[model samples]
Target: MRTTPVERPTVLRRRSYTWFPVVSGAGFYVAAIALPLEHGDGFASAILLTGISYFCWLIGWNSSFRFTRTHVSVTNVLVTTTADWRDVAGVDIEGGLAGLLRDGRSLDSIAFGGSLIGEFTGYRTHRRACRLLRQGWWGAGPGRRGKGPVPVRTSVEWRRALAIATALYVPVVLVQGLGG
Candidate 1:
């Protein structure tokens, strides 16, 4: 008899929202170039527009959730955190999949996370995504009983990537505010 080996972790993403960013990013990128040419605007407008485009692209392409037998990794717009199964108290579905920690903290998810408009419209995808995440959490059994430390670490690389995106807006804001 042959036993099956463990497979890869399940990855969940908001595939439906992908096009919004692509279109939005393209629009902003066009504006970044067109505004500088037409209005002869300073670097501020270009910087702001390009920053917006980068953020849109990042949200569309980078955010995701990976659920493994031992842990769950959540990648949001700003950060990517990996939480051990034992640290997860439960799953929260406030139009997205958020992990409720045993210590009363909540880690929000961007992938499959809905906007206020989508929530009001009662989008079904959030519920489905949450159900799958809940199943993975419960199946792991570590949340109830596990050994060793329950560590939740944020990826340094992801932090740096988001920091660069945020930095793009800061200089433009400072320059504009200083009357430059």
Candidate 2:
């Protein structure tokens, strides 16, 4: 038998959404400086607005679904959940793209917009993303490797970027407490 090389993970995200975070972050940063200077809200307000800008940038830039040979990882605003191919029961597209686990847990994906937004737009985007995820799931299923059902092992990790963004607001709170 021939030995094959390991494959790299495939990441899925909306290309059209790439401009939102940058534009919004810049807008918020400008408002942060302008509001405090024009309206005299003090440094606390400016810092709080800057924190919100960082939060938007962090969430928009870091969230996506990554599919590897062994598992599928869903990255949301702060938490990332990775489920093995054998642990995933199926894909749920009713709300958005979600992975239903055999252990009765569901990991929601941020790569697709929610159903509320889809209700106005007709769910075309959600359907297409769901199809891609389902294809990856079947392509990496345990049956293809001749493996039986194994114990469900789902792992979760909180991204440090979120903590950094949140920490931006601490100085605002401290400044406000000092009666600035």
Q: Scored by CA lDDT, what does every candidate get?
A: 0.73, 0.68
Clashing pairs in 2: none
lDDT string, candidate 2, 1-180, tens digits: 999888898887655454587578768867665553434466757787787788676567667787887788877766676777767789987766687777667778665757577777666666766787788888885753223443444444455774765565565455454553
Q: Clashing pairs in model 1? A: none
Candidate 2 has its poorest 10 consecutive residues by lDDT at 144-153
Best by lDDT: 1
Write the residue-wise lDDT of candidate 1 on 1-180 in tens digits: 999998798977776776789689879877665553334365667787978888887787667787888888888765788887778889988766688777677667766665887788676667776888899889887436444445679874556676766765565555544543
Candidate 2 segments exceeding 4 Å error:
1-8, 15-18, 33-42, 110-113, 120-122, 144-180
Model 1 residue 21 CA deviation in Å: 2.0
